[model samples]
Target chain A: MSDDGFLRVADVSKWYGDEQVLHDVSFEMDRGDVTVLIGPSGSGKSTMLRCVNRLAEAQEGSILLDGEEVLSPDLDVNDLRREVGMVFQGFNLFAHLTAVGNVALGPRRVLGLSEAAARERAEAQLERVGLGDQFDSYPAELSGGQQQRVGIARALAMEPKLLLFDEPTSALDPELIGEVLEVMHGLVDEGMTMLVVTHEMSFAREVADEIVFLDDGRVVERGPPDQLFERPERERTGRFLERIASHD
Target chain B: MAGATRPATVRERVADSDRSVGRLLLVAAGALFWGWLVVSWVNRWLGGVLVPVGDPLVPPGAVEATLAAIPGIAAYAADAAFVVELSPEIARGTWLTVVITAASLVVGFFIAVPLAVTRVYGRFSAWVSLAYTELLRGTPLLAQLFVLHYGLNLGSYVPDTLSGVFARNVVWVAIVGFTLNGAAYQAEYIRGAIESVEEGQITAGRAIGLSKLETIYYVVLPQGLRYAIPSWTNEFVYLIKYSSLAAFITVPELYYRADQIASETFRYTLIFIVTGVTYLALVLTASKLMERVESRVSIPGLGVDRER
Candidate 1:
C-alpha cells in the first residue's frame, strides 16, 4: 500500500448465506487519483464498491479511510458512508426532488446545514459540473448524460473524501456518455479521489491514474494505465482485452 | 296429403303436415306442470301438509302486497334527515368506529413499518416476508373479526383488555376487530410501497451517510408514500365501511341506529338501501381526494424522457 493512500480495502469478504460474492479482495487508493475498476458482469466489482461504502456488509475484512477502520463492526458506519459518496449507474436521484434539491438533501439532513446553505453548496457543485443552468430541473427532465452529471454533482456537494462510481456511463447513450465523462474528467482535474467501474476503455485509458482489472471476484492485474494498457503481463489480460474490444 | 301436397313452396308443405298435431298436448304439459304446483301449494295453504311430507306454511302473496304497500313504504323511506335525526346515536356509533379505525391505523403503522422493513430487507428467510403477506392476505377479514371479537373474547386466561373489553362495550369489540383485520392488510400495502422505492435511491441515501433507518424515513418512505397514496386512500374507504361491522356489537353507530329505526318501523329495505348509498358517497369522496394528491406530487416528465 502507498504511504499516501486515502482509502484501503483489506481482505474484504462477503457472502449471501451459501453463495459467496467477494473473497478477500484487497486494494489501496491514493488521494486525488481516479482508480477505475474494469471487469466482466457479476465479477463482484460493484459489490466491492458497495462494501467500501458499507452499502453491503463485509463478512470478513475491513475498509480503512485515513488510517481508520471505518467498516469495523465497532465503527460508526454512517460516518463512513457520509465521507464516501457513491454515484450509481442508474443515477439515483430522488424522483420527488428537483435536481438542486436532490443534491442539497444529504448535507441538509445529515450535516445539519440550513436549507439556504445547503442550496448554496448544491448550486456551486452543480455549477462546477456545468449544470448551473439546470439547477431546478428534476432528474426526469434531464437526459441520461445530464442526470448522471447531476448524480456526480449530488455526490460532490457533500464534499466527500472519496467518490465511488458504479458504471456511471453504462446507462447513458453513446453521445451522452461524453458529457458525463467530461464532468468526471473535470473532477479528476481538481484532484478529487474517485473509484469508478466502467466499460469505457478510452475514458479509463485517458483519465485513470491506475486501472484495476477484476475477473471472477479477484483483481487480475492493476498498475499505471500506460503500463497495463501498453503491455499486460498476463495472457488472460490479452484475452480479456480481446473480449472487451470485440464488443464494439 | 304428404305426397299430393308437394305444393308451391317447401315451407307451406311442411307446415301443412305438422299442423295435424293438436295444441292440446303442449297445453296439457304446461297446465299439468303449473296446475300440479298450484294444487299442491293450495292444499298446503288450505290445510297443513301430512306430517313432514311438505312445507305447511301459508303461501304469501308478497309481490302484489309489496306493490300495494309501496306508497306507504316510501312515506317511511330514509332520507338525509334520518342521518340528521340519528346524529347523536349515529355520532356515538360513528365516533366509536372512527376511534377504533384511527387508533388501529396509527398503531398499525408502527407495527407494519417495522415488520415491512424486516420483510423487505432483513437477512432472515424470504419466507419471513412471504408468510406475513400470505397470512394477512389469505384469511377472510370476517373470520379475523369473529376470532378477535368472539373466539379470543371467550378465552379464559387472556387479560381484561384483550377479552374482558368485549363483554362490557361495543367500542372494545370494534377496536379489537379493527386492529386485527387492518394490521394484516396494511403490512402488505406498506411492503409494496417500500419495495417500489428504487434500490439505487437507498444506496444514494447510504452514500450520503444516512443510516438504514434514516434512509427509509427520508428517502424510501417519501417515495413509497407516493406509491402508497391511492392504495392508502382506498384503505380509508375500506376502513369506513369496515367500521360498520361495529354495529353488530352494541355500538350504536350509523348503521346500528338505522337498523333500529328500520326494525321498529319495519322499513328494513328502504333504510338499508339508503345506507348503501351513504357508503357510495363516502368511497367517492375518498377516490377524488386520492386522485388530486396523485396529480399534486407527480412531476411532468417521467415517461417521455425515457424515449428521448
Candidate 2:
C-alpha cells in the first residue's frame, strides 16, 4: 500500500477486562477500496474494524484514519462515529422510524440538512440499495436483506468517509445474504472506502482489494487477495482459507 | 402402605387428589361470597338503623316549610333542567380539576421516570424499589392528603392572604397530594415498561458508542415510553378517581360540589348521578385522545399495535 493510504493501523491492541482480544495488529486500507478481514469466530477481526471508529478502543498503538490519529488522547469519538458509519449484524435500525425516516434521521438531525434535502437524500440512498419502493416500510416489515440495505443507505446518508460492516450478512438467512452483499459490492464498484468483517469467503475473494486474516488476537496475514489467500506463505492462513472454503 | 396388597389404581388416586383441589377452590369461593354477603348485610342494617330506611330525613314537622320551599327548589330544578345554569360551575370546576390533574401528572412524571430508573437498575438493594412501591401502593390517599394539608401544614407555608382562599380550595391540595401518591405507583409502571424494552437494544446502542444517557434518551426511552403509554393512561384514569379523595379535604370537586348542592336542595341521588356522568365523560375523552396520539407516533409502516 502507498504512504497516502487513507486508514493505517499499526500495532493496535485491545482488551476486555483482563482478556486481550486483539494483539499487535497492523494493516493499511487505501482510499476507495474494500479490505475484508476474515477469520474464525472470536478472531478479533471485527474488533479491528470497530477500533477504527473507536466503538471498541485500542488499548495500545496507533490508528490513523485519513492520515489523522483517530485513536489517541484527543480522539473525538462522536465525530469519528459520524464520519465512520457502521452497519450491525442485527441491523439496528431505529424501530421508531420508517425506512425513509431512519435514513433521514442522521442527515436531518446530525448534519442539519433541511427536511427537503434530508428526505431527498434518504430516498436517493434507499433507491441506490433497491429500496426505492419500500422507502415507507419499517424495519419490522422488511426482510433481513432489505433491512441491511436500509442500514447501508442509512450509513450512506451520512456521507461518511468510511463504512464498517461487522458480519453484516451473518444474521441473514443464506438466501437473504446476496441482497445485502450486492449493495455492498455496488459500493465497492462506486469506489467507497470500507472495512468488512465477513465469513463470506467467496465475496471476499471476489470484491476485496486486500484480505487481512486474524486469529485469537493477532494478524496472521495481510496482502492483496491473490498474495494473501493463494500464496499466504503461512500455515495459519492456509488452514483459515481451507476452513472458509469448506463453508462453500 | 408398602404392605398394601395392590397399589390403588393410579387414575383413581389422581382423580381423588384432583377432586380435593377442586373442592378446596369451591370452598374458598363460597366463603368469599358469604363474607361479602355478611358485610353488605351488616352495612345495610347499620345504614337502616341510623339513617332510617325509606324515610327522607326532612326537617321535622316541615310539611308547610317544604311547601313554602318548593318554589325555590323548583326554580333550582328548572336551572338544572335548562342545564346551562350548571355549565359555569361545571366549567370552572373542570378548569380547576384539569389544572390540578395536569400539574400533578407533570410532577409525578418527572419524579416517576427517575424513580423508575432507580427501581429498574438500582445497585443498592431491591428494597430501594420494593420500599417505594410498597409504601406508595400501601398508604391510603386520605392519610396522604391529611399529611400534606394539615400534618405537614402545607397550609401554614402559604401567605395568610392566600391561605384562607387557597387552603379551602381543593385544587392546590389535590395537586400536591395526588402527585406524590401517584408518582410512587407510576414509578412501578415506568420501571416495568423500561424493563420490558429489549435488553439487546440497549447493548446495540452501547455498541454504537452512545453514552448510557444517550442510549436511554435516544434508543431505550423512545421505545420504552411507547410501551409505558397505555400503563400511563391507566394511571391517569386512576388519578381521576383518586381525585375524588380531594373531597374529604374539601376540594369542591364534582363530588364535593354535588354534596353541597344536594344538602342545599335535598336531591342527593340526582346530583350524584350528574357527578358520575361527568367523571365518566372525562375518562372516556382522555382515552380516545391518547389512543389517537399513540397511533400517530407508532413505528411507521408497521401495523403492530403494541399494547400495555
Candidate 3:
C-alpha cells in the first residue's frame, strides 16, 4: 500500500507441491507503463504474471492493484479480474463462439450489458485489433494470427484497468507473429498499463518502458529498456542478454 | 473430336438410364416372387381351413362363402371396435405413458446435470455420484420398477393428499423408478461429455474471469450436451421401450391395454402384432426427432463432422 505505483507486488513466494516456482518476487509498475518480463524458459516469468492476477496463487506475500490487496482471502477475485485483462499464449478463444461472441461474452455476462450493446462494444474492440471482418468467424476457422487478435479483442472489450500478456505470440506462426504484436504495440501507443511476459526481444526493446529480467525465480535486473539492453549492471543479466542476442 | 464426343456422351447417358431401369425391373421381380410365396403360404394354411379349396372335405361353394367372410373377420380383428370402442382407454394409457417418459426425462435431466458437475468438479461429490450411478445402473430397470411399486409400500409414509395420489395412480411409481434409473445413466453421459471438452477451454474461461459455475453453464454444458447426443439418443429410445414395464405395475400404458385386449378376445397374435408395430413407430419417431436435434446443435468442426 505504501507503493504509489498502480500495481505493486511485494515479497511473493509460490510453490507447487514441494518445488518452489517463485521466491520473494517483488516489483512495481506505474500507470500506463508497459513493463516487459524477460527470462529463460523456467525462470518463473509466466508464473509471476499469473500470480499478479491470481490465476496462479502466491502462497506468501501480498499483491496490491490500485491500492487494494489482491492476495487477501476475502477479495472478490472476479471483480478484481474485471479490472485486469489477460491474453494467454495459446489464444484460448472459445471454439464454439465466433470472434464477436467471444468478445461480447464478458460484457454481456459479467458486465451485465444488453445483447445489442455488448455486441456493439465487441465489434468496436475487434475492429481495434484489425479483426472487424472476422466478427462471425469461429476460433477454429481463424488462423493463429487472427485467433490471437480476437483474443486481444476479447480482453480489450472489458476495458480493464490493466492488461497482462503471457507470450501472446509464442504459439503463432513465424509469419503470423507480427499481426498480433502490431495490435499490442497499438495498445502501448494508446497508453494501456500492460505487464507482458515474452521472448520477443525486438518487441520488448521497441515498446517496453521498463524491462524486468528474471532468473531462477528472482528479479536479476530491471531498468529502462535501453539501459537494460545496452548496459547491464549484473553479470547474470549480461550473460542472459548476450545469449538471447546470439540466438537472433 | 467434338462429333465423336457428342455421340459418346449420349450413348453413356442412355446406358446409365438403361442400367437403372434394369435394376428397377430386377427389384420388382424379386418383390413379386416374395409376395406370391407369402400369399400361397397363407392360403395353404388358413385358406384351406376356411375355404375347403383343395380337399372337398371342403364343399364346392365354401370358397365363395369363405371369400365373403374375409372382410368380416378383417373388420372384427382391426376395425372400429379397436379404434372406436377401445381407443379412449388406449388413448388414456398412451397419454399416461407419454407423461411418464417426459416427466422422468425432465426430472432426470435436472438430477443428472448437477450430479455430473459434482462428480467432475467436487471430490466428495464424485464418490457419492459414483456409488449412486453404479447402484442404479447395475440393477435392472424392471427390478427398480418392482421395488418402487410393490416393495416400497410408498403410500403409508406419505401425507393423506399425496398418499391418495400414490394409491390411485401407479404411474407415479413408474415415473419415480424411471427417473432414478435414468438419471444415473444420464449423469455418466454428461460426465463423459464434460470430460471430453479440452482443458484449455476451462483455463480460458477462468482467465477471462468467468465464475466456475458460469463457465460450466455457458462454456462446458453447450459443448458437453452436443457430445452427449449419441449416448442420449440411446437413452431416449431405451426410455420409450422401457415405459412398457409400467404395464406390469398396472399403470395401464399401451402394452397393458394391448395385453388386456388380447386376453379378452383370445387373439394374442393380432393384438401383439399391432402393439409391436406401435412400439416400433414410437422408436422410429424418437430416433428421427433426435437426428433433427443432433444436426441442429452439432458444431462445424466437432462431433460427426470431425472427419470432414
Candidate 4:
C-alpha cells in the first residue's frame, strides 16, 4: 500500500502478556476522513485506536502520521499525544477542575499558553461545543452528555491533527447520546480527521466516510458505508451486522 | 389492646430505666471532669495572688487565713500554690512542644511529597522509598530520638555557637528525628491516597499530552492530597502527642518540665495530670484546625462532602 495516505496504520499487532489482542491490523485514512471501527466485544478495536497515539504499544507495526513514524521508540510520546487528542468512553474529565479548567489545562500546561489566553481559548472551544453556559460546571455536576462535550472541548482546545474517540457514546444514556453525537457531527462537518471506535450504527452509517468491520482483531471488511452495509462481501460481516441491527 | 402497640413490661421498663441512668451518670461524669479541669486551670494562673499586694480593699494574707480556717480547704490551697508555681515553666515547655511539632510537620510534608511520588511512580526509587518507610516505621519514635541524640551523638557535630541556641543541640536533633519519622508515615498516607485516585484520571492527564511525572503532579496529587486530609489530620494529632518523646532527650518539652516539677515537689499525680490535659488541649485544637483545612480545600461533589 502507498505510504502517501495522511494516516497509515500498517500491520499493527499488540500483545498483553502472552495474549495477542491485535493481529496485523492495517488501514488508511485521508486528511479529512472519518473512519469508524465497528466490531463485536473483545475485537481489539479500542486497542487499535489507542496504538495511533501510542497510548497502547503496537509491538509489531509502524503507524506513520503525516510522514512521521508514531511507533518510533525515541519519539516523544507527549508530543504525539498532543497532536492526537482522544475522547474516552467514560468522559474522563478532571473531576477536580471546572469545565473551563478542564479544557484549559493542556494549553496552559503543555502549550504554555498564558492563563488569560488559555482561558480565552478554552471558553471559545466550550462555546464551539455548545457548552458556553457550563464553563464552571465540574465533571460530577454535569450530565453524562455534557461531560463528554467538555471532554471534546478539551481535545479540541489542543488543536490536534487527529482525534480518537474510544466508544465515545457507549456509556451515555440513550437520550444523552444524541447531544454528544451532535457535537461529533459538527466536528465531522467541519472536516476534523477522526478515528472513532463506536457501536452507534446510525452514526457509523451517516457520518462515517469509510466503515472498517473488525472481528477477532483483524479487519474483516473495509469500504464506503453504503457498500459495506447494503451488501457485505464477507459472511462474518453480514452476521455481525445482523446481530447489531437486531439489538437496535 | 390486641391492636395497640405493645406496652412496656416490668422487666423492659427496668432495663430502659437502667439505660437512662447509665446515660445520666456518663453526662454527670463528663461535666464533673471538665469542671475540675476548668477550676484547676484557673487556680494555676491566679493562686499566687492569695495575698494581694498593696490592695486597700483587702488585707494581705486575709484570703489565706480564711482558707486555712476551713477543714478541707487548706490542702486544696496548698495544691493550688504548687500548680501556680510550676505554671510558668510548663507554659514555656508547651511552647517548645508546639514549635517542634509544627517545624517537623512542615519539613516532613515537603520531603513526603517527593518520597510519595517517587514510591508510586519511579521504577528503581520505589524500592528505596519502601525501605526508608519500613526502617523508620519499624522502630519506636523514642528510640529514633535516642539514636539521633545519644547513638549518633549529634551534639558533637554542632558548632559551639549553634549548640547554645538549640538547647545544646538536643532540640534540633529531636526535630530532625521527628521530621524523618513523620516523613515516612506521611509518605505512606500520600501514596495510599494517590493510589486511591481513579486510574482513568492518569490516562486523561496523559491523553492531554502530559508526561507521566507531570500527570502525577498535576492530576494525581491534587485529588490524592484531598483524599489524604482525614489521615493527615490523624498524623497531626499523632505528631503532637509523640512530640512528648522529645522530652526523653532532655529537650525540655512539656513532659520534661512536668517530670522536673513532679520530682521537685513530689507531686507526681498533680503535675502529670496537668501535663496530660495540656497535651489533650493541644491535640484537640490541632485536629479542629486541620479539619477546617480539609473542608476548605475540598472540591464540591468530589471525594469530600461540600457540607463538611
Using TM-score as the measure, which candidate wins? 4
Which one is best on DockQ? 4
Model 2 RMSD in Å is 13.0
Q: State each model's CA lDDT, in order.
A: 0.74, 0.77, 0.82, 0.88
DockQ of each: 0.47, 0.24, 0.53, 0.69
TM-scores for every candidate against the unseen true structure: 0.73, 0.73, 0.81, 0.86
lDDT of 1 by residue, B1-308 (tens): 36665436888767766664444554465454335434544444456353122431222233334444678665443443343343333333334444566776667666667667777878774467667657766887667666765777633445666654433454665665676567667777877888977787887888888878888888887777667766777677788788777776555666776788788868677667756755555455457667888788866553233324
Give me the TM-scores for chain A across all models, comma-separated: 0.96, 0.97, 0.97, 0.98
How do the residues B1-308 of candidate 4 rate in per-residue lDDT, one tens digit apiece?
Answer: 48888889999999999999996885676565445444443444475353332121233255456666789788676555556556566666776788899999999999999899889988899999999999999999889988889899886787777677755578888889999999999999999989888899999999989999889888999999999888988888999989989888888888998998788879899999889978887786687688789889878778844225
Instruction: State candidate 1's TM-score.
Output: 0.73
1 or 3, greater by TM-score? 3
Q: How many clashes (backbone atoms < 3 Å, residues ≥3 apart in a chain or on different chains) does model 1 have?
A: 1
Q: Where does model 2 exceed 4 Å of error?
A: B1-99, B110-143, B155-170, B198-218, B257-285, B300-308
lDDT by residue (A1-248, candidate 4, tens digit) is 13349999999999999999999999999988999999998999999999999889999988999999999999999999999999999999998999999999999999999999999999999999999999998888999999999999999999999999999999999999999999999999999999999999999999998899889999999999999999999999999999999999
Per-candidate iRMSD: 1.5, 3.5, 1.2, 0.7
Across A99-205, the per-residue lDDT of candidate 1 in tens digits comes to 89889998899898999999999999889889999999988788998888889988888888899999999988888998998888888888889999998998899
**Candidate 4 colliding pairs:** none
- Which pairs clash inside model 1? B93-B253
Error of 2 at B211 (Å): 6.6
Candidate 2 structure quality by residue, lDDT tens digits, B1-308: 56658777999999999999996885676555345334433444467553343232222335444444677574454434523334334433444565567788889999888788777766674567678768878989899899888687675565666565543644576788888888988888888888977675665455444556666777677777777888888988888767877878778666676677678778677666766766776676567667887887777533255441
Q: How many Å off is the CA of A160 in candidate 4?
A: 0.4
Query: Which window of ten consecutive residues has the lowest lDDT sum in model 1 chain A?
Result: A1-10
